[model samples]
Target chain A: MEIVVCIKQVPDVPTVRMDRERMTIIREGVESVINPLDYIALEAALELRQKAGGHVCIITMGPVQSEVALREALAVGADQAILLTDPDFAGADTLATSHVLARAIQKIEPFPDLILCGMQTTDSDTGHVGPQIAEELGLPQVCGVNEIHREGKFLVVKRLSDGFVDTVKVTLPTLLTVTKGLCPVRDLPLGALEAAFSTKDVLEWNMTDLDLKKEEVGFAGSATQVRRLRTPPPRGSGDIIEGPPDVLVGHLLRRLEALSILDEEDEKK
Target chain B: MRLEPTMKQAVIRRSVRKFSERRLIAAAVEMDKTEQFPWDIAEEMAGLQYFGLEIPATYGGAGLDSVSTAIVIEEISKANAAMGLCISVHNGVAASPVYLFGNAEQHRRFLNPLAQGKKIGTFCLTEPNAGSDASALETNAIRDGGDYILNGNKVFVTNGGISGINLIFAKTRADGKDLGFSVFIVESEREGLEKGPIEDLMGMRGNPVCPLSLRDCRIPLENRLGDEGGGLKIALSTLGGGRLGIAAQALGIAQASLDASIKYAKERRQFGKAICDFGAIQDLLAEVGTRIEASRLLTHRACDLREKGKKYTMESAMAKVYASEIAVEATRVGVQIHGGYGYTKAYPIERFYRDAKVCEIYEGTSEIQRVVIARELLKG
Candidate 1:
């Protein structure tokens, strides 16, 4: 049960500011933290390793400063931390980011038996990287996993999809994109923090180390470009209807139909 | 010359803040109202080496540096000052002296459990007659063959109710002559050791501060900490370090109050605008914010000095006095910013106000801190 957990360091959401002029996020001077959901994934991986007896290795692809996130994960009980940092890895979209992650995973000796990631990152919120990494590695993946159980080389997981609870059992060497309830992230112990921050043990991988070309890793490999960035329009105030529960339900259905969020047939059902 | 917190210290602050916010904040209120120690939370904290913040890892301690240790206490105090007081006193005054003075056998026997958090530790010095004048302690440890017969009553023993190990300061009497003060590692379960009822307090009510009495308590000669007459030296040195922990605690309380004030000012509307929009409210916020920031710098400077093994007695005294004073002031301003709402328990500002006052009073009063600073300045 060698597990690989992918993590990203993003600007703390509350402190984030948009660079209106440059049409991008203002990252300088802002505090960075591991994505909250990624913490859940890491927590899940640790639990699995605890139950199955395997090493949990955490990896992240970002600038040198992103080592903070890796150190944090190490402090939280990750067995190993690999920092994937390179100037050539800048401006990577979900596609290129997953490619680099997949390549790094392939380079791991004996190859990881399981891969894990958060369902989405707070900064990008694309929910694409996990599935893309699975596709690139040709591994089966389950997204939005909320519960996990291990049984004899198979993992049974539960997730919510289209308002339906789906319990899927997958064989070994699979990937999972965990959601909030996968496990609770315990606070990192203070004793481990000092060594984690000071230790030079974090393995660093660059373009040359991963056998990756510059054009296929960074901005050049990105398939999507932001033509323009704008804040979403403020929502208008909604009508406050005073009615009984039954009447409120009827009114809600009618409004949904009017907004084309639901069709007349679905409303009838 | 660098003023900014190092990356490690910054992460420590963030990590402790998250743990405090998510866990300690809610427990603080409940503990305050109930006046009961949360042993469960204590156990949780022990697992993270909160009790052994400066103890070496070889002895089951966290082994953090002085600055990082202070940061931890500060963040914990921010969420719950009572619990903060527990850790600060346990680590700074009690466990620290044992590590600094105790020999190998003592470290293996006493420091191990204290660092492991398996046994809560306390520094029992203040008695009925010995408040500011520590030498006035009437507690006597007389030489009686291989054992020392100790008779004294220690009052206002912080963490007394839950402490398993108590560092008792007593006057050593041999051949009917006083041999100055000496410290003894007195286990709470010893015969003649009795714990008094918990005191009803204004702030930090969750801490079980009580009186401890040793009625003809007998202990082996090995129980004496350091030399037979080295208690005062250990006490002075330990308290100097202890003041830094108190300063950090004060800074935490002050920071918490400022945060509450800022949030409340922005939300509470008066005269058709949020109170934050008013110039008077802004002045209060700005003043408290600046003071809290200054308090942090002063506290961190003392921590830095201590960490680097430099002379920080005066610096720690200054930090303790300034930070504690500003904590009281910040909480006052916090309550004022909240107006009438701050007067009630509806907001935590009132709790912060109560918790901040004790920071000035404990470890050493603001006046005592000033005295220490003056004594250092006048040294030839």
Candidate 2:
């Protein structure tokens, strides 16, 4: 089985500063890193490849700088990396991005038996790319997957839904959007990085390479447009009531009653 | 062109940072308290090629440049100084000499295992009589048929108890006259080689700094590194690079000290505001931060010269002395910033304080570094 992992390079900061006027992230002075959840997806792909005896290929849609993330993935034991970079591929929304990725995956040699992706990206947080790509490829997909394994010819997936875990079995040629709880991220070996840069080839694909048309990718193909963006307001602090236990209880009850959080009839009963 | 770490080097730094944050930093206090060698962490680092930073990839090493090697040491030392010391001694002195001076067969035997982390290595140069004065070492190696019998006690051997390959230097007599020195690769499993108990130290307790006694230990003729009486040259060259490693380690300790102080200052309140608001605390922070950046630049300059195959003896010596002294001072200020809590075992600042002092004394003392710098200047 051949596994393909879709990765994204996100800003390496807790809170990203956004350019509200431009409706985009303020990339200046911000360092880029592999998306946190994508590391879990890559780890999952690597584990499965280790057991099944196949190649783990990582694909990412970003600029030339995003190749660092792909090389990092290679350092952690990915067999190959394909970078989708082109001026036309910029400003793509989730639907356009998934369409481009699906075309790129089809261009990979030997094809991919399994496709893996993070549930959502930290920058966008749309959580639509994985399912959209699955739809684009005409393949089965599992979203928000916390655990996954191979059972015979099918894949077993476990995901939490409404506070209960749902386990489902799906056939091959499937896409999985993994969560952070899947597995621990492995360290990148120094020798592996040296070997990757010196020996491994990180193939680059453009619009022509993937046979993508101008109307199907990039800003021209994007269906959603952001008119404005802003950071959320800071949360307000809670009120603390302090006194003796009886007095505190009385104050809490009176406050709750004043706020109408408690029913007077129920309190009397 | 840039003195800062390259993109690839930055990746390496981040990887090490992640590993150290999760593994070494959490276990540092317990390891210090128990005085136990962190074999597991060593194994993990070896798997990550931390032990083989400067070694060539063909020889089961990472094949990174000298600057990258220093970065690895600095990052690791920031988390745990004792582990840093072990790696410095192993890579800088022990494995490096064998790779530089050893024959093909010797490299295949000794350097391979050491680089692979299957076996730990250490340099045995300091004797009871020879601390800074290496020529005064009393250990003697006698030439026997097909073997050389080594009889000496080496003191303060880093990674001594756990090491498998020991690069030992001893005085040799040739033609009825005492020649300079000879280096030998003595395996720890050899007969008559006894490892002393771990030293009870004020700092860097996690390192197995111990004594080794070699009584009639017979090493094969091929085990000798370089030529007869060529040990001094080998020792000098190995230590020239080793000083940079120590400097980087010191820089790491200093940076950690400043980090701890800054963290504590922000959270610790006094006089109705955080202590960080005070002018005195801010002064300490600024001075330490500047010193650390200067030390890093000096250390990296030495590394750059070494990588370019230029003479960096004086540069490395200057860096070592400056960085080590700053480390001691910075940790002292770190402890002062924490006030009473820094003195207790509850905080890591106390551990940093204890670990900082030894950086000035090891590899080469600050006095010795100053002397080396002066000697190089005089020669020019």
Candidate 3:
């Protein structure tokens, strides 16, 4: 089995600041890390490859600095890393990003048997790239997958949708976006990073290498434009009610009734 | 000329910090309360090569540099000082001596398991009669053809209860002639070897510090680490490096204390405002913060010197003394900042207080470290 994991490097902050002028994230002065969900995706790919015995290749589209994230993946048992970096590939929205990713995936020799991605990135939170890439590549995809089991050439994945746990089995050559609980991320071995930095090779593909025209890749290729970006206003403080359990319950019930979250009759009962 | 860590070192610190925070912190408190070595966590850490920080990769070790190795110990110590002590002693004194002095056969036989963390290792030099003055040991190894019969009681053995391999230092006797000091590689399961009960300690209670006694424990000739009578040289050189590890561990404890103190100061309110608002509290925080930074610089300096293959005996001693002292001081201030709540078991500050004191005592006492520094200084 040949698996390809698509990952992104995002700011490590919980609540990211926005660059209002550029209508993007403010990455300056902040530490960049692999998107948490994307890490889960990488972990899932590694686990499957471990059981199936195949090569695990990781690909990411970002600036040159994004190579660090790919190097990190390589340090943690990934066989190969592909950095799709090009100045023309900047300012790509979900559409252009997935297009470039899909094109890059198609360029892989022997063609990947399985494609994996995070359900969403921490910074963007669009949750659109995975499905968009699946659509472009014309392959089946499952989003928000929490469990994956390998049965020969098929993959059985479990995910919670609405209120029910849905177990779906998909054949080879499919894309899946994994969330947390797929697998626990292992710590990188002590010398693995130094070895990767010194010895491992991360292949870099520019827009020209991917045969992506400028109009089809970066800002010009995007269907949606971010006209403005602003941080949401801070939430007001909530009242902290401290008392005995019954007293706390009474106060909560009265507040819920007053807020129309609960009926007065129900509160009385 | 550079003070900032390299890219690889920075990533290592980040990775180890994440692992420590996620896995070790919760287990640390539990281990302290139960006084049991967390074998499950040890297995997890073994997979990540925590046991083989400085061992070469060919030997199934992580083969990290001194700086990176120190960073790992520091981060783990920050999360759990007892485990930190376990790793520092194992890598610094036990496994390291084998790699530094043991032959190729010894490397294949002993270093493999120790580096892979298959068997925890210990450096048993502290006897009841010998502590700071390592030369006054009473343990003796008698020659008997192909094997040596060893008899000694080693007390305060770090990782004694859980260790699989122990490096025992003893006086070698052949035909009633004393052959100074020699080190023997003794397995824990060897006959006539017994482990006393784990010590009930005030801090670092998670580590099962116990006494190990050997009565007629026979060790093969091949188990000898170096040339007979080379024990003192190996001990001195090995403990030089071990002191740096202790320094890193102390730095971690100090840093943790500072972090807890800062967070507590900002949140703990007294006299109608956060205690951090007062000038006195600010002074304490500032002093501890600066001291922790200083300790880090000294530790990192020692790590840098060791990594560069430079002579770092005095530097390591200086680092060890300063870092350990600061660790005690930082935790003291941490408790002071937490006030009444700190005295209780409610906060980790009190545990830090207990754990930090041993850093000054173990590996080498602060007074002994000053002796080493002064000797080096006068020689220079």
Q: All candidates' TM-scores? A: 0.94, 0.95, 0.91
Question: Which CAPRI quality tier does the interface of model 2 achieve?
Answer: medium
Runs in model 3 lying further than 4 Å from the true structure: A147-159, A164-172, A191-195, A219-223, A236-269
Compared with the true structure, all predictions reach lDDT values of 0.91, 0.90, 0.92
Cα displacement (angstroms), candidate 3, residue A3, comes to 1.8
Give the per-residue lDDT of model 3 (tens digit) for B255-360.
Answer: 9999999999899888999989999999998988888888888888888988888999999999999999999999999999999999999899999999999999
What TM-score applies to chain A of candidate 2?
0.96
State the lDDT of candidate 1 residue by residue for B136-183, as single tens digits.
Answer: 999999999988999999999999999999999999999899899999
Which residue window of length 10 is worst by lDDT in model 2 chain B?
A: B171-180
lDDT score of residue B85 within candidate 1: 96
Best by lDDT: 3
Ranking of all predicted structures according to DockQ, beginning with the best and ending with the worst: 1, 2, 3
Considering only N, C-alpha and C atoms within 3 Å, which residue pairs clash in candidate 2? none
Docking class of 1: medium
TM-score of candidate 1 relative to the true fold: 0.94
**Winning model by DockQ:** 1
**Per-residue lDDT tens digits of candidate 2, residues A113-160?**
899999998988999999999998999999999998899999999999
Task: Give residue B275's error in model 1 in angstroms.
Answer: 1.1
lDDT of 1 by residue, A113-154 (tens): 899999998887899999999999999999999999998889
Candidate 1, superposed: residue stretches over 4 Å from native: A14-16, A151-153, A236-269
